[model samples]
Target: MLDDLFPILADPDFQKPGSGLMSFPAYVYVYPPDEEYAFREALPQLQERLRRPNVGQNSLAVNIYDALVEHLEEKTLGGRPLLDRILEQEEQDPEKVDRQVKRHARSEEFVEQVASRFSAFAQEEGGLDRSYVFVHGWGEVHPYLRASQFLDLMEPHLRGYKVVLFYPGTYDNGEFRLFGELSSGNVYRASCLNERLEA
Candidate 1:
């Protein structure tokens, strides 16, 4: 199943994070496990539309967000989602969502750790997808995260990549602030793009 969908990531030719920047709108389409076949069937058509190997230096970054949700073995210590381990509150606590996500994001391998706990496919697929992991940690680390650290470490691997910010419940104070601090033009909002949710 993994081999059929992530050929680009598994192949030997894809660029690593630090080597060079891939073009924008790099779609890291993360689909929870059950949706695998639908996503797999759509890949070639989707890639053909947006991927531009001929345009800009290496623009046209695209990665499929493939994972199994149940593999995470996530459960509530007290009838709440395990994510509360970091949030330290009931899963329904909206205000604490952001705080909790940040509290737990300070690890040296935040995304990798999340993958370990939740998604079994992260490590291998990460390399295949040329994934740029995003994580929050220890109270508002979002504003201070510098890709340079990632770029320094990953340049040798991914060459250039992206790290989207995840704010759990709301998108209040994350990548929006980081991009503003860096004065960059590339910050995007996932909430607005979700047609299923209110914008």
Candidate 2:
């Protein structure tokens, strides 16, 4: 299964216009949540493979979990990280803290921050046109932000680039069921790389 994935990912035409299911080049690679560790273990090797001859200079692998954390840490309220302020309120009102965090997660500010990080990484790592952007860690940033929502927000930023979302979930047809249970919603624009593997 691992061996087959490389050839599919390395295919230069995979991201070209009118390729496969999507008119755009975005893709979702669903895997069982139980196997997240295994996938993480193989991530470096997968990145290395993308840097090999046919795949281009190198791929930009962005763990959105890290991006979100960095964004939260950077955002300060009254000379303290917003998350720290939230932490201070946690004991006094746990529910309020949850709501506040969730609110922040769904904020345009947070979305833009994460998107900026992605674009910066893409630009620094050979730009979108010349490389693949492998996005993962959606599970960690869940409940607050759905994979469907993040991908939807990221669509404009990723217009010309090929993207493979290493989603720890299930995407059948246009519906995405996170962890194979929670319905993340329908997303038809991004092709399913798992389907390509079966093909």
Tell me the alpha-carbon RMSD of every candidate: 12.1, 2.6
Q: Give the TM-score comparing model 1 with the true structure, all chains together.
A: 0.29
Tens-digit lDDT string for candidate 2 (1-199): 2456787767777645346545456788888899998888887888777776656646678787777777778999889888788778989999987788778777778778766765665567443344567888889878777777777777666644567788888877678788998998767777787887788
* C-alpha lDDT values of all predictions: 0.33, 0.74
Model 1 CA lDDT for position 128: 33
What would the TM-score be for candidate 2 when compared with the true structure? Answer: 0.86
> 1-199 in candidate 1: lDDT tens per residue?
2223234332234335432235431222223334445544554444443233431111221121111122122535577655445344545675675554434333345444443432232244421343334332212233223232322322323324543322222223323223223421223422222222222
- Predicted model with the maximum lDDT: 2
Give the runs in model 1 whose Cα sits over 4 Å from its true position.
1-75, 83-99, 114-199
Model 2's C-alpha root-mean-square deviation from the true structure amounts to: 2.6
The positional error of residue 169 in candidate 1, measured at the CA in angstroms, is 21
